[model samples]
Target: MKATKITAIDFFDDLSSPYARKRFFVGFIVFGGLCIVAMYLDHQFVPNGAIKAVLDSVLANLLSSILVILGFYILYTFFIGPNDGLKEVVPTRARDISEAMKQLPEKTRSYLFWGRSGSYFRSSPLIVLDGYARRSKIMTNVDVLMPDPFDERLINSYRDIKDSLGEESDGNPLLANVLATTICCAVLNANNRYLSVRVFYSAFLPAFRVDLSDNGSILTQDDKSKGALFFKPSSEFHELLRTSILNEMAVSREINLEEATFKKKKLDSGSCTPEILARFGVAEAARSALAPKIATLIEERRHRYT
Candidate 1:
């Protein structure tokens, strides 16, 4: 079957809804409150002599504490809070582009993974984003890390290109979404590949770095006499890889097959229906004849941003 095509309209359609806007405001308020409370507690409990002296000179400690808390509440609520809002608001356009890019085809996605090698486990965020972008038909550009002169110029040029394509002065929102999606895609693909390889090889592989050539190339060493070295995959091995991919896709998309399976099994159960089984693939079934584990590998990374 052909893959689904996602469009820019699909990406941005639900974002501007009243419900979404309310949720965004609620999130900002909660974050700002937490920041204010933490700042107040730190300033109050830290016991600074200078602060004590100032309090003694101006007012009592009780009043001082109250004043500090009120001051910080206002400061954070007004200045810092709105800055955070801008960060969210400005990134909406970029985010839409990133989402649109996710619908790209797999062959195009694989190009992002090509220039890197080293036990396959150390594949970076950029590579994964490229792969997903190619696979999903998403347009993505890597933020290259290099020394000062090259780094600044390259990144600036990249932003300029993105802005030109996007028809916006600042590509901040789109860039933010691209970076976020890149990280998400990288983590998801690497985890899937790592689990698949580990199951296939029955061994753990250490992550390692790979150096890429200036022209974005990597050399693969081949031992010709060892015919079918990489080409030889048993039917069982192919099944395993396919199953792993399906399960990874399900988990990434937050689809709970087990619940669906359970409801279906109650209705009619010789084994899982072909459609359900096909959606998850065999590895999921093999993991448990009854239920598949539902959890987010990507959600764990939310702490990094929050």
Candidate 2:
């Protein structure tokens, strides 16, 4: 088996779209008929002098209007072109996005999570979450979120990158999916270090920054809105992160085992799933499992900071 080549066209091609070529043929035929009718009318009506005068006047006015509009458009583009590039101004926060993450409840805040674009997550993260996970033992606070490689959503999400990976590993029984395998390798590498790791079928929301703590913050910027301020997390921002994480965790759990479970690991069982999800960081259901544990950790941090 081989990976299907990904091109711009492959991703754009609607896998289930109804055949539409026949509609194009119908359009061309209609256009031909209209052209014939126009030619026939031209031959049937010989413009008398009055009609010709009226037609000339209409054409003249139309041409003059078009030229004026075109000239105005040209002048607008010429003057506006240079400054147009600078029109979009990104907000300059007093701190970077990671600084906002630091304001989250300390214990739950250390875990680095990924969602949506794995490629983008590759770009930004906190210093502690980045390197500390490797150096420290599985301290109670360290956790990480990742996609379950065997889950269908995992491959389908990054299916666009298979072409760049050189071959589809999914085609063979022995070969695993390329991107999945890479992530799996990373998980194994971290697991060996005693880093707490959880894998899911998909993400609840797109990740802007990696702090997964219920108390953490997410910064949002609109391309259309210029000079927006980036501030530390407010209570509302904390709620937003908490809710989104809980939703994704709940949905991932709600997916039927048969549909969502990639490999039948120990956590797949009914009794074990909730315990594992809680340890891994699902809120509502997992609250019983880890909330007090996290709260205690936060208190410990406050004491240390003092």
Candidate 3:
């Protein structure tokens, strides 16, 4: 025979139930003991009959008020405790990226896009690729600045993640996909819908949520993120990104992902010229480093012959 564990919940249910006569009688006995103690203290504290009578009345009122308040609290807790969860909200201060993803609207016009950097390097654009492919969203015509397929920083980052999290990320589908392909990955909810947009910058992703709506809000992972001011996408920034991507698509030769290869002869500094990227507010150092990487990827594409 298996031994049954007696839980506080089971004990509490018996004691609190109306039909528990023995328990209720014992509770009254305890209450009587408490009353005796209170009365003894009161008599000792106020020996004068006239003053003691007045003090006793005041104390009785105070006790009655406290008891009433406590009774109300107990009643409310018993009646509303279970179902009150539905009405409770996760305040913005308490919200994290994971929680924000959970509340995302299934079909939305925009993604809450953000990705951290390698201190100064541009974050990966694989997040965009993953979102576009997984969502199969024709309506969401958003612009994304992508890294070269074989960008040194990007490739290195991918290798680092794969080596570090190959087996560890197995259970987490999102993490697994991200590890599988360093370039692009998306996470799906229990319903298999796309979760909010954000990219992995380092090996570990922090829990933070930002809603990139017309009027957006941010919930960061920690005090550091909290202190950092979130950026609002400007029209100029949006247009610049769109133009950059379109320009890249226009100039690049068609090649499938698997078939793509770097062309040493075609690789030129002009492919990711700083002059072009500078106009779009890309930092001088970032643009200089990023240009070559971007150009190399573009030049390397194996153009299909008609």
Candidate 4:
């Protein structure tokens, strides 16, 4: 009935780890036994005369060597100490957004993703719709935000950027796919009773994509080739990203998709009804152009499962 609380320990803890706790206990015991043996040997081997002097000199040299090593280590630690636990949490770099999503935990209390056209999220290996549906069933609060596809100027500008980046040149097909994906999201929401899904349309597009889960946050550029930045839940960067997304959500227009439906019959027929598009506010003229693209997306998904 209540949302699950996810902490640092929960995110870091591999739910199905193969490593055993007993092995660590056994290793600790072995280390203690070795230390006892070494101490015993040192007690028994107390030398006299020239042997004593030689042993003393050897001990002094060994102690000096250890001190020198410790000093160097201390210096190294002094320089790197500020980043102590931080480096372990943050990866070197994510090659792209998908790679960055892989860094986040699979289970979360809440998940928010705001991007252009839901393109990456729709096709992401980490955030597949089937998995998302399952998460929704478990009451994960999911929010999806993107630029309004119906906005001609916005789509044109988006297409231009994609063209510059050598991506797909046709924004119309992309917007159609985006609309199809929106219908799928509506299907998810209608099936689930909890805080499952909400879609928001913004007048303007963001330069970068933001994905926030219970575990952490990942900020990525629109261009897939560019690197992404990730921050753990408690970090300042993470909070900043979270706050920015929340603020953006406050101003964006959240659309109602209650009328959108995807029956098995529709998939078999390879058709997205105009009524669904009407609910999404797709203009009459654009519906014809989008219909085939929507059908293509549905067929591809069907093939994926069948």
TM-score of each: 0.18, 0.32, 0.26, 0.62
Residue range with the least summed lDDT across 10 consecutive positions in model 4: 1-10
lDDT of 3 by residue, 22-82 (tens): 4555665566556566767888886878877886776666566656655764675577542
**Residues 59-165, candidate 1, lDDT per residue (tens digit)?**
44444555575566556646644322111112223223222222222223222222111112122333444455546654433222111111234346545544654
Pairing residues by index, what is the TM-score of model 1? 0.18
Q: What is the Cα-based lDDT of residue 2 in candidate 2?
A: 15
lDDT against the true structure, per candidate, is: 0.31, 0.36, 0.36, 0.60
Over the full model, what C-alpha lDDT does candidate 2 score relative to the true structure?
Answer: 0.36
- Count clashing residue pairs per candidate: 15, 1, 3, 0
Candidate scoring better on TM-score of 2 and 3? 2
Ranked candidates (TM-score, high to low): 4, 2, 3, 1
Candidate 4 ranges with C-alpha deviation above 4 Å? 1-84, 88-97, 103-105, 125-137, 171-174, 259-271, 298-306
What is candidate 4's CA lDDT for residue 36?
56
Clashes, model 3 = 3
**What ranking emerges by lDDT with the best candidate at the front?**
4, 2, 3, 1
> Which candidate comes out best when scored by lDDT?
4
